[model samples]
Target: MSTAPKTSIIPREVDALKACTQGATYEGVIMPEDLPRLAAAVVSIQREMTGKVRFFRDESNYRMVTAELHTVVSVQCQRCLSALDYQLRAEMDLAIVVSEGQLESLPKEFEGWLLDESGSADLYEAIEEELLLALPIVSYHDQADCSASGQYSTGDFEEPLAEKKNPFAVLGDLKLAGKADSTDKESE
Candidate 1:
């Protein structure tokens, strides 16, 4: 059997971002598998990532891009050891920068968009970075449904941690001894 290739089209051509209509928007969806970095972060890529990139001229007349994206991906639940549907969402407000110095002066509200030497930003790559950033550091199912939820606690089936002594407690005792010795020496 043959399978269709998961191909995507992004605006990364020469001069793709050279000029922008102050208020133009580009919107589309990309299969999760099309984004290698993001695909590698999850167990499976079974959903389409939807997003839109809007171009606007900031007050300084610098090119600004804003993107909003969200998707549902399947990740292995850390607690249940099963596949879980994890929701990922991200919003980006970036100021296109041509020189390294521009990044230092970007407004706090805008993130620096360091375009390559060719002056074009990989549309898919940028979005993929945003998605990866939004992914949970450790994905897990809800407590009510997790196969091993609460089991990691001491009262649960897991072994309890042994009680530990405070290492600094001896310092306090040493201080008391010094004070007592000083008091006796002074009194004598």
Candidate 2:
């Protein structure tokens, strides 16, 4: 195992950006093992995404990181109640900040952190946060493609019929008719 940090472009030292100076750019891939928290979060949802990160910094102490991710995710169709696979494409942008306090003490709006005092920045946390934030709150597979088998077809199913019984009808006949009706609908 390489003891070196797995992120490709993180600087070893933290540098202060002057008000009028141009910031630096860092690019790299976040190895899966390097992001345990993030990996766990995604894996818990049973999805896998991998991609590259590009971070740009400005002299005004502002930083922006963009990530392009691709993965296959498992989702249940809301309309069909069936499991399906979905192709996920996600893009995210995050602002970065450098501070000297404990990471927990930082303001809520500070999107990410630069933890070192050596004039370089490590972007592992920032990248992880950005990717997580970009995940969709809800995702579903294409409905058209999901129902080809028609066995688990949602389109053919009707809304639950009202429970009111026909007062004049015989109870046994109604029960049998209801069952036959349901089966006939399924066959259609």
| Least accurate 10 contiguous residues by lDDT in model 2 | 11-20
| Pairs clashing within candidate 2 | 13-118, 13-119, 13-120, 14-118, 14-119, 14-120, 15-119
Query: Which runs in model 1 stand beyond 4 Å of their true positions?
Result: 1-16, 154-188
Per-model C-alpha lDDT, please?
Answer: 0.76, 0.54
Query: How much does candidate 1 score in TM-score?
Result: 0.70
lDDT of 1 by residue, 31-145 (tens): 7567888878888776788778777777888887888987888899987789998777899777878788888887787788788667766777777888888888888888889
Q: Per-residue lDDT tens digits of candidate 2, residues 58-153? A: 444455556676555445565555665655566666555455454455456655454454435445555556656655666545646655445565
Give the least accurate 10-residue stretch of model 1, judged by summed lDDT. Answer: 7-16
Reference-based TM-score, model 2: 0.44
lDDT of 1: 0.76
